[model samples]
Target chain A: MTTRTVTCEPQNFRRVLSSMCTEPHPLARQAASRFLATNPGDPTTYRTVSKLESEVVERLGEVTGQSDVEGYIASGGTEANIQAVRAARDFHDVNDPNVVVPEHAHFSFHKAADVLDVELRTVPLTERLVADVDAVAAATDRDTVLVAGVAGSTEYGRVDPIPKLADLAAAVDAFTHVDAAWGGFYLPFTEYDWNFADAAVDTLTIDPHKLGQAAVPAGGFLTQSRKIMDTLAVETPYLESTSQATLTGTRSGAGVASAVAVLRELWPDGYREQFETSMSDAEWLADALSNRGFDVVEPTLPLVAASVSERLFERLRKRGWRLSRTANGELRIVCMPHVTRELLESFVETIDELR
Target chain B: MTTRTVTCEPQNFRRVLSSMCTEPHPLARQAASRFLATNPGDPTTYRTVSKLESEVVERLGEVTGQSDVEGYIASGGTEANIQAVRAARDFHDVNDPNVVVPEHAHFSFHKAADVLDVELRTVPLTERLVADVDAVAAATDRDTVLVAGVAGSTEYGRVDPIPKLADLAAAVDAFTHVDAAWGGFYLPFTEYDWNFADAAVDTLTIDPHKLGQAAVPAGGFLTQSRKIMDTLAVETPYLESTSQATLTGTRSGAGVASAVAVLRELWPDGYREQFETSMSDAEWLADALSNRGFDVVEPTLPLVAASVSERLFERLRKRGWRLSRTANGELRIVCMPHVTRELLESFVETIDELR
Candidate 1:
């Protein structure tokens, strides 16, 4: 077969402020090249890669403060969150089950409700744009199977009061899940109490692709116990293995190997430096935008959202500046590794001129 | 950060006969390296890679005989098949819905039923190990919202009579989906009537990772019309785009780029030659196994299944000859790209010596 002459050179993605994504570490890219033929779907077929995946699960568990964590590498946060919902529903065995999440929760919760036929009770956020424990208390009942807390919400980048939310859900024995897809790796570098060490929390959705510099679509789901994880296991006679407990079959071994490689490269010190740098850059950007008359939300991770006029938003976007807008029309910027101080300064300069 | 010294060299995967998997084409591996930082989730941020993904969808649609097809890159066949079921269930306001599939269908059908709260009615296969169209007709009724046919069954590589199955299901307005994950890329090389050109098939689960020589997890879900695909769309306010119809959010751009690279390398002639060589190899292996007194199932693709005693299966497995087994105890062997003639001949000699 003739290889095409088409060149896929990486474009200048540094100006992409809208996406909460980063480039994969060089080691991860190398690992993906090394394991292109492997598939982790059947552990027996690719034992080496499967072991790497399990190591990733274990290392993520340790970061979340769980000594004995049970989970797998999911496609991404959507599948991880959906799998968490499946685990909660099956473990509880309640009829017509419902889940309680804040209105600011990820849209994947809605997808899960639509797919699983579970009633979704979305509580209104507090004035601070965080999940209100009181509202969650009012929404839960004996039939509530799961209650989710958003750590580092997409728009505002605020960590919900997970400890309080878990306490509220514990009264009814509802499973607690923290969607740390954007916050899990960052929280370890901060003094936040959003981890498995919280006794009431049951599951966590962490994406290595977002902050850990893994290749895309590598979402990690960590649970409190193997029993809870096994609730979603289904038999797969067609595969070399007798059964599987994943959202998809025939998944990529490349994703697993790449994640392991990246995690190993940034185990303790390297990741902290990256997180601190991003946070510092975001703080600077927030200050600059505020000085220019923009009311910016205090970033919990490396995300800064500001109340901007629609005219300004449209003008900036028309100028080829990629920015995400919240439902309330706030301009959102995530300070990933690529989002350097120089890029933000240029963006600020552009904004000042436009204003 | 220090790069890890651990090596990830590709293993001798030719013995992995149980998997319907192949090494990614050289172009695909090169593409993954070129586009390691790109993501297809936010089109505005990764416009070029997103266009590549759409091109993949378009080319796959053309191969499946649908000129105006609408679809996306799914996680794998499971997500593609589940999305097809979701579209069918939502298109028709199905309540207490059931899907009728053949007994040899992939386990993803069972996963969909579990996740969607839909009942699965499995019709038994005929004596020839193919879907019994009459049994499917007898099993489906007013509540049957979808009918799925397996073009390439996992255990026994046999194409079902999809035309007959579709005619039977269309009598009651049930949606028709063909799980061609293993056979879609192969059928264009052979004379098979299991495509949308047949008029009865509505959706196809075609996996590039399985036979198109793309990286793992590159499953394509192509629908006959855009109207049906709209049923699966859900609003994603956080994304640059307004909504998403995919099973995942923040998916890897590597899979999409790799698939397009592989497809471009083997568009019309290159893929046909690969399939022909694999089919001939499969025939040779089947004949050799039969001559050694093992009863072999005639392969429709590059898969061969033979009945082996439990002791023999264990011995072969202990000797590192990877093989899959059917629910009825038939050992399966898939002749992928890496499974060369020399490897098969060595395996046969080993079996002869053991016998």
Candidate 2:
């Protein structure tokens, strides 16, 4: 037998600036390594990681102004959003279920609707690129089980008109879900009333991996009560426990531990300072891009959407600039913590030379 | 901010044998840490990890004796199985779809059926504790989109008649899926012909976390043809790449990297030696338990299904022996690579004293 050992040397992996959220915190890495062998299928079978998961849920609730929140750590935004739709489908007891969302909602909503076979009714965005409440009201009906709005949309990072959407959903007796996967952690630091305290949201999808600075694949699903969570639980007869409330079986507890560690370390003040700096950096980048004759949108939640020609986009992409684009073909640059001023300045210098 | 770091020292976390797989290979840890910040969402955005994920898929295909197989890493068994069922549903274009499986199949099937709103028809197991081919034939009909069989059932670790089941599925033009989440890696070393080279299976769900000794949350979904994989792809307009063929968005590269590392380290010879040792250990443990007045079934894989009373189970569990039980109340002990002879000897000594 060959005595082989796999080692990941620092030189083998070069860090890039396009990766947002900075590097994972030291506490998060250590926590992940500690719980690498744990599976949070049942608290009874895996007690340590299970307790850590509960504490993480509690911290998420307290910070989001929903003190009674109940949920589990999902794989990522996709699983969390799918679970939210499933909860809404089961809770409303509708025969022909459908989910209503804005056209600018995350692609995860589309994946969820397709997987669940639920009709996805997408409302067109308003002139401001937010979910138009009038359109949502027009799209929703008796069969509509869920009406969702985004806190930080993927395209423009604009917060939707969630309060108005919630009112409309309440009138139709539909469950309201807020997909705050990218913007949940930042909303607390901003002066926006987008959390559960200010809205009539029934479920929320928060991803710690996005803005919370945890390790990868740590998306959370939160609801107001256990009665709602029970709808997604499945019975696992082989294990010591009889039931599990997760979309995937044998989930890794590493993500949960890393998220809890990061949240515990940077709770009240550290994250706020980081959010402030990231938004400021975004504003600075947007101003630089606009000054250089590129049409850029105003900054919101550390994301700047700009219009660039296909030729320029190809050039920038070939030069190793990781970029995102909207359906309308607007370029998106998320000024995460890792996207420093020096990197943006260098990018601007290149754009100036090209022009 | 306080510089409080979460340290996971070895002594701080105790190791328990209830975990089926051994501690992840050191290479797996290094790979996870190296790619902790990378995601496999878009190949253009995260080029290195995306390429690595593709190589891992190709390696998985070659190892499973399907050189032309195409697939991606999933979150776990549940997601993989669900995606297979979804592929079948979409490819066949069935208005009212249903899946037929043996009664001893994993509960993930139930969850998939519930989420997809597809009717699930379960055939009873034969008296020999394996999936009865005749019963499976009786349960499937015109509306059946999928016919699935378990390579190693969660309860008794008995492999179903996959060859016969696949023949039956082919007769009705249904997509055949083999859920080898528990037994995929082992079958390569055994004399069994349960791989893609031997059966007419369309899709297979193999979890590296179970038997491959990779880190957690590494489930794989492989298809016989790329045409079938295209059915599960969703267009993501925001990302540079317009399409994705995964259930979750922003999947962790840690699982993929770790899985590839371990699979490379232990391929043809290393896994065969480990499997032989594990099987021998199981036989010895089963003999010891049978001699101590317990009714134990001869194992097909490295699992012993013993008939033990609730009282004895409670006593053994209290003494730190993590045990599993079947729906019919039979005790289960999976003799994985981690469950060494010394551990079995200690368990036997305790049972000897109790008897």
Candidate 3:
């Protein structure tokens, strides 16, 4: 009898292993090595998990100018959104709570609503592809527990008018949650003063894995009010002696340690420098794409979304440039710390030639 | 100006580091290294995560002589129970769904109910501290969606009469979930011929971190029916992407890698030998405790719970022995892979001297 053997592709193997140690910098590697050498207990304890969580939150508070901040480490942006929705719903005591979101909001909001059985009210976008605050205000009702404002919406990478959304939410006594998963790390360092705390947003979800180059599963839920976090606490003696304030117990301390290492290494100037360079690269990519006759959306943010006139995307793919598509038929090229200006310029040149 | 410098105690520093890496075994170290090297995406996915969830179900199928078995990876035992409760509630569609559990059942079941807002009925235990099947049968009602049987109750580490409980669940058409979190990795290799799938269990929760010596955050939920697992799925555009099928998204591929490495390193014979040795150590500990006149609870499986006569506990603590207490004044000591017969014997000798 003959047996078949299964094997994984070499590139895929490389990508997977690289994801384990996502940090490009050497300090992150040292911190991870040291952490693995030491802390090996279950990371569910407040003493261990909370200390790391508070460290991240404290740094975020300093960056955003928010002092009374309470945050919890989560698996990713999705879990953070789910927990935020749960807290908002339980706080408002809405049996069939509703969330008002822009059409371009991240899919996490829709996923949160689906899991919690909360009604989702999708508002139309403005001409600039930003959330139409008026549409959101018009959609709000007494049953609305949360009004979501997108900070760097996935489609166009344009931040919603958070101040206007906060005002609307305040008028209706609804909670304002900013989906800052993509923009939280950038906005604070970028010239844009779009911090959720300053805009009076109640809750925000941020992913360190996306911008900080930490390993996967490093995300957080930031809220100005501690009361909101209290509502999500579930007591269990099996995993936790006290109440587990997060969605999952027995979390990986390695991820937390990695985040701490990344934050420590990139204190004040490091983050600012990286953010500036990425933003500049985004602008350069946007200009190149536009000069090549592509309609680029929200050319200001670190994400450049463009619509190809011909088979430019196919040609770019052949040249080894990977990109994701938005619901609005726009291709999004996100400029991370790893993507250099030269690389973006070369890719844009290839696109122009293909067009 | 003199600045006050903060200093950490050597023990405290060691404890802080130890919290991240709880197990002090060489195998755990080797596994962690291999885990760190594995990636969570594609080709590395198999090594990153113990997609052995399906393998476990397959093993269960073979053990029970049942063909239909399904399983999913979970963060830990608590998450597994939470999902099981959610699935039961949604599948049964019972208004104010209730779960019947023994008084000594792991607290995760109660926590799951509290989080889901489902009614929980705790049946009283027998004099031996095992689940009284008749009490569980009497506690059932039309509102009950699940009857939970603990394979190893945390207090006394006694396996409930699962066969009898399954018979009772069948009588009422209630779904039976076995919380074998501590015992799942042990019973398969031990003398316990009871197959979880054959014992009328619709679902079983297992923790590889506890007994299998994998990294923390490694657990699983095994089910005999794919239909049950389907009920926990939250279908939304954002979360229902090609990869995720659980409550969490973007999990640590490192933890998954650790689980796979631990499981692979300890296959059929490895598991059997380790568990058999642990059982023997447990038996030796029980005998030593009994000889010292401590009211040692008889071994339910491999666990030995004892009442240390309050005065004896204080004396043991004074002698530098760390032990956990139960609700009913019982001291519990788990014999993990890191714990050896020598350590158990030393503790027993100390107890004898103190007594």
Candidate 4:
């Protein structure tokens, strides 16, 4: 008899969380403890979930200058993109829906389009790695329901020409959705003129977990159009309905509470300070990498994408520095709130020694 | 100057967790306390989520006799059913994929098939209010990839003849999926000879929150086949990957952890005892309603589907009793583990007086 041995080890992601919040503040711990004591159902679960959702939405609204902004919490950026596409498709009532996405857009867009059976038209990127507005304009047809602009492209961490793409989408009377899952939480506080709300885009994706310092499964889609949200609103007699809408049926109230906690703990100054620090660190890292003779893709915002020679890449990996490499031989490094300046400096110093 | 009021009322669901495990069990409360602390993205956060998911899956597995069953924690029964269908379609290589579902099956089947572009063929129910085996056999064609048999159909609460459905599906070489979302957690302990594993069904939907006395947003599709799970495994360089498979990325590890906790606290026998208690209460309520001259559908497994005339439904609603009425004038009273027998008697007695 072959016995199936099941060794219960905590998952890798959980390990990361433990390490990240090693010495949590007393208030944070207390907030969590309070929530656990009261396992209420939806809308009444944790004070934090609903509070945080509204705070984030209001903060986003203030930044975008949109008063009618509505947000729905999602598991991650992928789910956010999926919901956005579904809403756009349903709103346009297109039999064969099409979305204009840049070649460098997040994989979630393609996954969403494939799952929803929407036709995805990819636009080429220019030399500077920004979305080619002309290519996007050319891709548009009567069947096009959405034009997806990237606030932060994964490969090079460069923001797409949202103003140009939004203009094109506007000309064709199609909805523009910005894939801001990586940028939305940061761009609001950045010095860059990337106005998500003002950029003619109707829908935007934001991952609080990525840049807002929230846990995973805390992404959202922010929309200014009430009509678009209503199109995706699923009302069932069995389901507890809320004025707030979501693609999913049951949501984790805990996830919502976590977001609320993060937002409250880090208000206007905290968010702005974190964004400024990220920008400074990103600049310093880019300069250090360039000084060490590596070709760096300077970000339009706070991310630094550098391309190391094949030999150098192998040597760096052997030295134990984990960095993401794109297909075009570019390595991406994000300046997260948790990533300290010393850690960045040490990484650069180690790279210099290897070079 | 106009002042905008931002009401930060944390939703009810998040608060519910605190109340459910408020006292008596320190470990469970401690686990819940730990989950309340961090945001969803914190890797350490899996303790709470994974506990919930694993608990639910293990309990369902014990009932189904498939210990090696892989489970993906989803938002609700709708998402669980959708994910199961998606996996079936992709695994079987069904071009122009279609699913065979009974006419009385839950609406989620139609919604999922619609989203996946899978043609759904509804088989008519027999006079016994169960899926007709002959109708299901006739509905299968070359394009049929999945056949769904309802265990406790929402309207009738009657378990379909799985033995017959399994034989039909085997003859057609299609995957047999059982939508036991409402009954999977209870039917195993009921006086019914329905073993999920013995029935040879490929996938089974179970909602622990529904019958296992857990919170909402905790549902799963348990499967014995690794091939079916692999079909839904989405891989990306940026995403977390483990030996275990999942449909969605960045799952609520806290929810998963809570599920595991629930199962550990309530083993198969414990669950069986709870189910037996609920079943007895259901039977009692059904008898009481019938004795009082109400047209009550017989107690089917875990639920009692009663047909209270339209006048009676309004009267019951006015009395502050929440009961679901079916399209065919049937009212469903789900006897959950938390629902006390005394409460059941009181409700039934009140109905008797009205009748």
TM-score for chain A, candidates 1 onward in order: 0.96, 0.94, 0.88, 0.85
**Candidate 4 lDDT, A257-327, residue by residue in tens:** 55556666665677788778878898998888888777888866667778787787667656655445565
Interface root mean square deviation per prediction: 1.8, 2.9, 6.5, 7.3
Q: How do the candidates rank by DockQ, highest first? A: 1, 2, 3, 4
lDDT of 3 at B284: 89
How far off is residue A7 in model 2, in Å? 7.6
Q: Which pairs of residues clash in candidate 1, taking residues 3 or more apart in a chain or in different chains?
A: none
Deviation (Å) of A189 in candidate 4: 1.7
Give all TM-scores, in the order shown: 0.97, 0.96, 0.84, 0.80
Lowest summed-lDDT stretch of 10 residues in model 1 chain B? B1-10
Candidate 2: clashing pairs of residues: none
CAPRI grade of model 3? acceptable
- Indicate the TM-score of model 3: 0.84
**Residues B1-355, candidate 1, lDDT per residue (tens digit)?**
3446435633548577888878788888777667767777677778888889988998898778888888888888999999988887887776678899999999999998888778899999999888998899999888888999988888877888889888877987899999999888888887777989875898899998888888776888998877877788888886878778888777767778888988887977888888899899999999998988899988878999999889888888888887778888888888887788898999888787777
lDDT of 1 by residue, A1-355 (tens): 2446435634557578987778778888778778777778888888888888988899888778897888888888889999988888888968889999999999999999888778999999988889988999999999999999998888887888889888877888889999999888888888777888965789899988788788776888889877886788889895667778898887777778888998887877888998899999999989998998899888768999999999999999888887888888889998888888999999998898899
> Highest DockQ: which candidate?
1
lDDT of 2 by residue, A144-216 (tens): 9999999988778889988888898898899889988888878898776677898998889888887788887
